[model samples]
Target: MATKRNVSSTKEEGPVIDEAIERNWEIPDFTIKEIRDAIPAHCFRRDTFRSFTYVFHDVAIILALGYAATYIDHLPSAPLRLALWSFYWIAQGVVGTGVWVIGHECGHQAFSPSKAINNGVGMVLHSLLLVPYHSWRFSHSRHHKATGHMTKDQVFVPHTRKALGLPAREVDPEGDGPHSALEESPIAMLYNMVMMFVFGWPLYLFTNVTGQDYPGWASHFNPYCDIFDSNQVSEVYQSVAGLLATIGLLTYCGQVFGSLAMIKFYVIPYLFVNFWLVLITYLQHTDPTLPHYRENVWNFQRGAALTIDRSYGFILDYFHHHISDTHVAHHFFSTMPHYHAEEATVHIKKALGKHYKFDPTPIPQALIKSWKTCRFVEDEGDVVFFKN
Candidate 1:
């Protein structure tokens, strides 16, 4: 493992920014291989049976919740049924989202060593959730490759003042502008929560809504979209086929069980899964304390380090499969399975020391903070930090 040198000087030479984020700006003394070496070898190995166990476990809970929700649908009181249904959807939906995470692991080749098993399982699982697996996998690889690069990063790239057509000094440096007001407003929080959790995922995939722009428009579903090159077109077509097959299955379900039944049992939970997916990714990357680098300053270690580790409490962590809390490690080592992320993250944190970011800001507060303050990046720096 190659070790970095002159870390103290390197730390000082980096662009000056928010002291909070600048503290982590210095290149660490340890290298990626050293960080990997700290983790037990077993942590890097994929366990196919164990990975499948997690999938089956989440699916079992989803089925149980669905059955229970159906039984509660018979309740005499409308309010009781409504409350129970709401709880079931959130619970089952979150669990189903974990299923999606498992498939995502398959995409990263963290689920197993066999590419055939990974693609087969990921395609089936993501397709069931109305996601195009190969399409996402290809684009997501781009994201991991260039995580904090202001221009090259694929998703959740903060808009610049120019991009938003605002003047350079329009946003107050003192943090008391309209953005601050929005941050403190309950209505704004509610509005942001609604948009982020409800429509954020599909809009992102369909239109590249929060993503960085290519030469033209980009959509994950289009095989010919710039998101993929000609070499990768066939795989994207396979992804489209998976999506079409899922649509056919859902249509068949609607015909057999009635549209309302389909909505009650599947659609609501599907939306919830999307909500969780969007919320997780958004919060992971968007933070005032994180920096976005232009090409000249961006490096893989810095880009990967830009991710924040969030706590969703114990039960939510289980439902999310710890993706929220262990995301920093995942970014650093994309193929590390969720089951091993905690261990790897612990080692990385110790190795990285002050550079490791673990934000204890409650998720709701963090969401509001980012929505308000992380609106855009500095207009003219090689290393730009977020501002309102």
Candidate 2:
């Protein structure tokens, strides 16, 4: 819990996001207490009216998409039907999931002024999509609060080299490790493109593959009630409702589109959603150059600031409400609504200047690059690369 870090840099590694101390500057104790503890003023300048409008509009779109799926799907001709199917599946899956992230903001209570509103909105949308709203909210907030405190961090803790004859690496993906296997994937290379996009979220919460450990009281799998536990009744009930809704959707599609057409409708677009979701989450973090801290040296500011941002296209950007674009701001001020995120981010960058990290590469290329570069490399024994 060191509070102060030397802000000077003379090394030539080209602005990587490592939490390690650099050699040229003296590494000071960088506790959270030292890092401009004031929440930025920009955080308060939320255009709540506009954000509410956007949220309202996004909710409309979700209903509209579902309506489209349910009724007046497409023209009956084979080619025309195929075209409509292609448009909806591809558009809805990738783009639809983007709105879901906003719903995720609701879970974070970052979308609105009221916790009831946030939870209500999050509950509806997330439960509709099979996400256990309260479960994710509680867990995700823990991730933010304890971002890099090794002893108390929720997810993504780096494993030390000496621990398993490896440098500080990502913690184990299997049982008894940092997070569950479903949370992070060994196959993260094409993760968003296919593997995780389709199966990642399902496996993680349901199976607890790479998820955080809880005492028996908090298990997500159990349907029993417990306050302050992530795996609890609300999660179970909401998850059941979401899953049942999905089944109902499939059943409806089977009746209308026929078994084969329903299969096409259900699977294809869903693939796009999973792919993009996985990809977005992946590139936002998970760089080999980014260092994870150990118990003594970890700090939240350093951990949250270690994110990398890249530009996605305009169409996707509008659909997702720049959540991808505004994630840096989100990390810094988790309570800011999505609409205000862009404005807040602009100000934050101005203040941060070079302290900010950005990756100018396009998403496709970065995905390819990260695939090759970011595979399970552990922490280094020597702290020189991470020197202060």
Candidate 3:
């Protein structure tokens, strides 16, 4: 593993940079075992029954919501009916996201002790959400293994300055640097956010958008895509089949019960589910204060600590299974159940000290700030910070 060097003077190879930037960006010296040792042993245990209970709970709420939504057509006023249907979409979407979270837990093998149970449940839930389960699961494991690696990290890899056509760092000052006005404009920011939250998930699935660049065509649905190994092709094909089955089911429902009804109940809510999925993940990894490391400075422990945990409030946190607030713990120990993550996180914070990152900024504000400022990273640093 490489260690941080204290450079006080400007070197011929690079520009003069701030000492504080280098100081703050030093690679952590603590080992992963030290952090794991801080958490109680029981926190690592997965309860099969407890995990199934959450699955049932989410499913029950989804069915009840679907049943309750049946009455919207009976409302006397069109405006009233539309309002109620809108509410159902947002409410069901939130609950549906909870289901997605559970599926995600299954992908991480944190839902149950048995791999059979975890994969079986995960396939069903993820297929319902139109996700390729095994494909995402395999790639997500890679993400956990290399969370902040500039090239190896699976998702939300920052654009390097060279990629964005920005000038060399030596040409610009350390603190005051050139920023693209149009890219940072309010209108541009809003447009980018809308595109990201609305279509980001689908784009990522189909085209590997916002993911590490791979040779040739890359897609979650493509078994032969560079994202998966030859040995994993069978599982990727299984995920594709599951998605096809779900699509066929949805199509049958559309034929049986008018396309408009299907749109109102399923399609809209599904989009919102995608929105929440993208929002949660984007905010977790992308932040101004967070550092992305070149291969030399990157290691599993440092890469894992690159993530930030943010509070989405009690309601969102609960329904979302605390994926946002307890993310640091999740990265450190991917197999730890979500039920015990909050407890694990408390001990992790103590163990990590200043290396632990938790951003308490309200979700909306944090979303905007990250979008505006975290446009790209310098192409030439061992440890790089995002720059506008």
For each candidate, what is the lDDT?
0.82, 0.58, 0.88
Expressed as tens digits, the lDDT of each residue in 1-388 for candidate 3 is 3333433222333422342266555558789999989999999999999999999998999999999999999989999998999899998999999999999999999999999999999999999999999999999998999999888999999998778776666675533243767777788878988998889999999999989999888999888978999999999999999999999999999999989989998999999999999999999999988878766567899889999999988988999899999999999999999999999999999999998999989888998888878888766556778877
Q: Across residues 1-388, which tens digit of lDDT does each residue of candidate 2 receive?
A: 2222323222332322233443232323343333334345556543546656766776676557656865434556777766766766776675567667867888777766777777777777776565677766766787776654444555443433344443233443331233333434546434554655577656656654334444454444456523235445555566567667767877887987699765555566666766676678767766555544444444567656666666787788778777687777788678777666677677666655665667878877776666554434233221212110
User: Cα lDDT for residue 306, model 2?
Assistant: 64
Clashes of 3: 0
Runs of candidate 3 with Cα error greater than 4 angstroms are 1-23, 172-178
Order the candidates by TM-score, highest first — what do you get?
A: 3, 1, 2
lDDT of 1 by residue, 163-282 (tens): 876655635464424545655578867887798789889888888888877656689877787888899999988988999999999999999989999999999989988988988898
> What's the true lDDT of residue 267 in model 3?
96
- Identify the superior model by lDDT, candidate 1 or candidate 2: 1
Best by TM-score: 3
Candidate 2 deviation (Cα RMSD): 7.9
What C-alpha lDDT, on a 0 to 100 scale, does residue 15 get in candidate 2? 26
* TM-score (all chains, Cα) for each model: 0.91, 0.72, 0.93
